[model samples]
Every structure is written in C-alpha cells, then in structure tokens.
Target: MPKSNTIPVVLTIAGSDSGGGAGIQADIKAISATGSYAASVITAITSQNTLGVLDILPIPLAHIESQLDAVFQDLNIVAVKIGMLADADIINLVADKLEQYQPKHIVLDTVMVATSGDLLLKETAIGSLKDRLLPLASIITPNLPEAAALTGLAEPKDAEQIEHMVTAMRQLSTSAVLLKGGHLEASDESDDLLITQNETHRLSTERIRTPNTHGTGCTLSSTIASFLAQGEDMLSAVSHAKQYITQAIGHADLLKVGQGRGPVDHFFMLHQ
Candidate 1:
C-alpha cells in the first residue's frame, strides 16, 4: 500500500493585500500550491493594487493578539511565515504570541516596501522588528532594500558586497539570513545567499524578465515554510523554494491580475 499524504498546516502572519497579489493572499496561494494548508493572522489590511498601495489600516493590537491566540490554541501549525506587521504594537504582539506557542519553523519576510514602491512597514517600527521579532525567526528573508535597512548598509552591488552585508545582518540575530539578490542591478543571474551558523550557500538562476513580478517575495517565503512543514530540512527547503519561484516567475505572463506588475503564477506546475 502507498503511504498517505499528510497535509501539514502552515500559518502566515502578515498584512492583507486586497489586490490578492501579495502579502497574506500570495502566501496562502503559494502554500496551497505546495500541498500545505495555509492559516493566516492578518496584521493589517491595505487598499491597493499592482500599480501601488493607496491606503493601509493596521489591525488593533488586541484584535491581532486574539487572532494569534485563536490559531495557536486550535491548530497543529507546523511552520509560520511572517510578513508585514505594519507597526511596533503589532510586531510586539506577534513576538509575544510566537514565543508562547513556539511553532517549529518560522520564516520571516522582512517586508518594508511593496513591489510598487509603497511603504508597507512604518519607519518607527523598524527598530522593534529588529530588536524583538528577528531573534524568533528560523530564517529571515530580505530583498536588497530590506536587507540594507536591516543592516544599515548601502544596497550591495555584487556578490562580495552582499556577503559582507549578510555577515552584518547575522550579528543582529541567531536566525539564518537569506539575502535576496533579485533587486541587484546589472546582474547576469539573480542570486540569493543563505547564511547559517555552520555554512553559507548560494542559489542562483537567470532572471526571468516579466512585468508580472508582483508577489515573488511573499510566494518564495511561504513556499519555503510550506516545504519545511512537509518535513524537509532548511537547506533542502530553500533549495526547492528557489526552483519553485523561478518556475513561477518564468510563467508569470499567464496571469493578467492587475494593470501594473501583475503576479507570478503560483499554480504554474499544475498546468504542466
């Protein structure tokens, strides 16, 4: 007899993107595509589209805390992917809840700005995020701009600079760092550096040129968490996630979700 498929539950604690291209929406889509159940705790709600973010409404700390409690109390959550928390209060609240429940895998996407250049995290809350939530993460995934913000280093232009910046970021927390290189200019191939205490690994691939690159960050982090929930080791999980995102980006033109930078096709594998 064949073994049964176990559907591991993965939680995403992030903001709601009304456009359905990024944030909690993208996380759920990517997790579902990877054969995991996605449960969400919304930290904020945004009125936005692929073109840009118009407005944001931060969820109350009390309400956010209740939602976290509700999920942790009932679910056997295997991994947690955390995205935009919006404010200091929300960040603090999530940190407290995660400490209490202590989920096995926590992948933190330090979302500071959107693909459309709209600010997602408040300037004041950056400190709180670094001081409190970062240490709790199992791995912290930051795009170039977000990595610069965290490390107080200028945007790295090459692999050597990126490695140096990653070293600085590692000192901030015990969590492993995945410094994304997609935003680097003039790159022959986009590369991501994953630095853990024991070793550093590089995952590189040709850049898929597509306007539909709206939710790549959200999708990548969520997929990584999903793989971890399915019992893959961290290195294997990140490696698989790189392959998944590359495929999604390659097939991004299939989606016509919005007027501007649409969305990566999270279900691209199903069509093939």
Candidate 2:
C-alpha cells in the first residue's frame, strides 16, 4: 500500500543520544510535537547523558549509505535537518546523499559541540563540511563558537562583532545563515541574526534563565524543519521556531529529568 502524503514528513540526519535529550531523540520529539512526522538517519551513536558524552561509536559508512538509501527511497520527505557529523568521511557521504536526493528544505545545524562541553565533531571534518555540505544546505543554524570555527575568526563578543562575523560567513555558499546569539551570557535578550543574500533579519526573544537547556540546538532546527515541511517560508519558519524554543526553555524548569542540564519540554503545551 502507498503511504499517505497528507502529513508532512521531516528527516533528521544526526547522531544518537542514549539520554534522549539531544540528537535523533530530540529531533524526533520536536518534529512530532511541531505537527509533522519525523524520519531519522543516525550518523553516530553516543553514550551520552545530561551530564556529558562518555563514548562515541561511529556507524559504518556502508551502513550509513544503506540507511540514507532506505529513507530516500521510501519516505516522502519534504525537509531535512542535519546535525552532527563525526568526521570528514561522514560529512562527505551526507553531502553526497543530499546532492543526490535534493530535499526541498535542508536545515543544517552545525553541531560541533554539545551543551555538556563535549566535542561532537572532529576538527578535521570542518573543511569537508565547509567545502561540501555548506553549499548544499538551504540554511545553516550555527551558534557563536561554531560560526567562529566555520569562518576562522574568534567568537563574537558583541553585536558589532557578530555583524562582522556574519559578514565573513556571507562568503559561504549556503542560501542563508542563522547566527544564534544565545551564547552571549551578558544579554537579557537573545538576538539571532538571519542573514540571507537579499537582507538580514534580527530575531530577538527574551532569554529565559534555566538550568535545563540540553538539546536546544537540535530542537530548534528540527522545529524549523517541521515548519518548512508544512510550507512556511524561510523567515516565517525561523520566527516560529524561535518562539517555540523560547517557550520550551521557559517551561523547562518545570521538568526535573537529570542531575546536570536537562532537556526542554518538547511537548510543553500539553503541560499548560
């Protein structure tokens, strides 16, 4: 029997977190909570909890290829959210599949580091991600440090420096860049700059203070993908995603999941 296409399907290509706070787990939860069916291809598996990552096991390249083929062949995927790529080989392979399959909206969350201060991607993979995957993405969501790493500049210390960093990032091949400013601890307001080829839009939301902020990047990017899968424009998708993540973070304090950082309430509305 043919599958129904009434509901939009969003694909997440990332790692797996045993703790279910980030990566494939978070992506699935966010996508489903945002009103879309979620599909996934895990690039790596991490023995991770809210505290930190203990070990990482790479999915064999052939198995990764098989997984990509299986999904692209069968699923009616409208959008893709790409997260952590452990090395250059995996990056190249994902780039190849993306180019071959050509999903309509590809949101790349440059997942280089985890909230636990653990490294998720290797330094050697940066060049491959830049040369290969960046060009294929519809938009990239990068936090300050990831943006700095991509552009070879220090992390932006202020709004002016942020603009400068975005200017440098403009040379990259992606259609747009969402430079997340949540890392600026001094700010009461969180401002993320959306840089398109035509114009730049500033997305600002109140910074909610909470100890539970794990999976924020994954959740935000997946939510954006869900919106895009549902036919929202670039700016609208990003705007809605920002609003959603803020609420999720604001409600995060209500849930006590882990000893360290905790996951956001992907289904926060249900609790309301």
Candidate 3:
C-alpha cells in the first residue's frame, strides 16, 4: 500500500481499455496529470483500439465490491469518477459502494458507446443506470447520444430541443447534469450545458479538429473529479476540465499512437 499523505486522492470505477486511451487507463492518466493520486476499481475489461472495440468482459460483482472496499477503507478518496459499467448488476454494486463510502465528488461519465460505434453498456442495464446510479452522482457528463438515451430525446435538432433534453435529464435526479454537445453536428464551436439544481451554465470552446478524440469523455470526467479532489468547487472543476481537454485535443496530433482515431495527449502540458 502507498503511504497515506495530504496529497488529494481520486478513485475511478470503470472498465479497462487495453488500448490505454480510455477507461481506467485514461482516468489514471488524467487524474495524475491534475496532480492528484489515482486509485481504480475496474468493472470490466475491453478489447479495443482506436479502430474499434472487439469484445467486452464484465468483471464479477464480488471482485468489484472487494476492490471498492479496499480503497475506501484505506484511502481518503475525495472524488470518484465512474465509467462503462457493463450491466445492471455492476451498476447496482457500484451504487451500493458509493452509498457506503459517500465520497465528496462523484463524476459519472455516462459512457454508452465508444467513438468507433461500439456499445459499451448492455441494453438491459440502461434502465438501471437511470433508476439507480443517476441519482447518486454529484454530476453526470453525457454526450448527445447518451443524453438522448437517458431522456428519450433522440436527436436534439436545435437549442430549444437541447434544452428539453437537458430538462428531462435534470428531472431524473437532483444531481447536476452536464449535457455535452461534442457529439452534435456542429461546424464551429462545441458547447456544453451544465445544469445544476439551481443554476444553468453554457460553456463553449473552439473545436479542435482532430481525429484523436477517442477518450475525450473519459478524460474530461476524470479531470473534473481530479479538480474536485483538489478542493475546487464543482463549477470551477467543470470549467478547468473543459480547458484541460481543449489543450489535450489541441495536442492530439503530436502523438502517433494508433492507425485510426487516436487518443488525446493527456500529458501535453507536462511536455510544454
């Protein structure tokens, strides 16, 4: 076990992306990049690369429980980032753990499908994610497809339609909803909608044209958790995460990792 210290600790519960661009690998990289210690509890293993996902194997629920128990018992985990829970059972187990540990910051990247058009979560678990896990998160970061899945909004064509989607998601839980517009068909800027219980914020950044946006959602959510673990408020955390991911996407072309869509440069700032 690593020695306990005052350094902020962030925990991630997600799948393992063998490609190392997303899931637990991306979470660790993003958290560490934010100067926070990262611990992980993997819920599934995925055989994937920039091209596509080949297969997915969900971890046993008991093993997932054990990992969560070990971390919460030892580490003062300040924030948790959850991603790619494979089934309803896995989602329930994760929710139970969060209930037990009650970490201060919880960021849920509602990862439904990969950038390569592969489904990450089972169809049967969608209801469970909305009914059980959505309520527990401090915030949920969902791209257009994920938001549509949760809210039954299909494709939100205009700003008013997008607002309707956001309202539907906010109705699910008191937790804040971060509806990401990255998946939308936009020509200029990608805007993100952050809707809290009492406030609504629209954040926009100039879109960096890159094919290396494979794990952008995972990176953003984990980075938000990292900032929250560092004692920043939710609004500040989201803002900083957006800035960090913009820089990462800007540097994506520098790293020649895979044949198809590559990964964002998580440590680009370090190389500067």
Clash totals for all models, in order? 0, 0, 0
- Which order, best to worst by TM-score? 2, 1, 3
| Cα-based TM-score, every candidate | 0.96, 0.97, 0.96
Q: Global CA lDDT of candidate 1, please?
A: 0.91
The better-scoring model by TM-score among 1 and 3 is: 1
When sorted by lDDT, best at the front, the candidate numbers are 2, 1, 3
Q: Candidate 3: RMSD over Cα atoms?
A: 2.3
Any idea what lDDT model 3 has?
0.90
Which has the greatest lDDT?
2
Clash pairs detected, candidate 2: none
Task: Report, for every candidate in turn, its global Cα lDDT versus the true structure.
Answer: 0.91, 0.94, 0.90
Ten-residue segment with the worst summed lDDT in candidate 3? 181-190
RMSD of each: 1.5, 2.1, 2.3
| Model 1: residue 173 alpha-carbon error in angstroms | 0.9
Off by over 4 Å in 3: 1-5
At residue 249, what lDDT does model 2 achieve? 93
lDDT over C-alpha atoms for residue 101 of model 3: 83
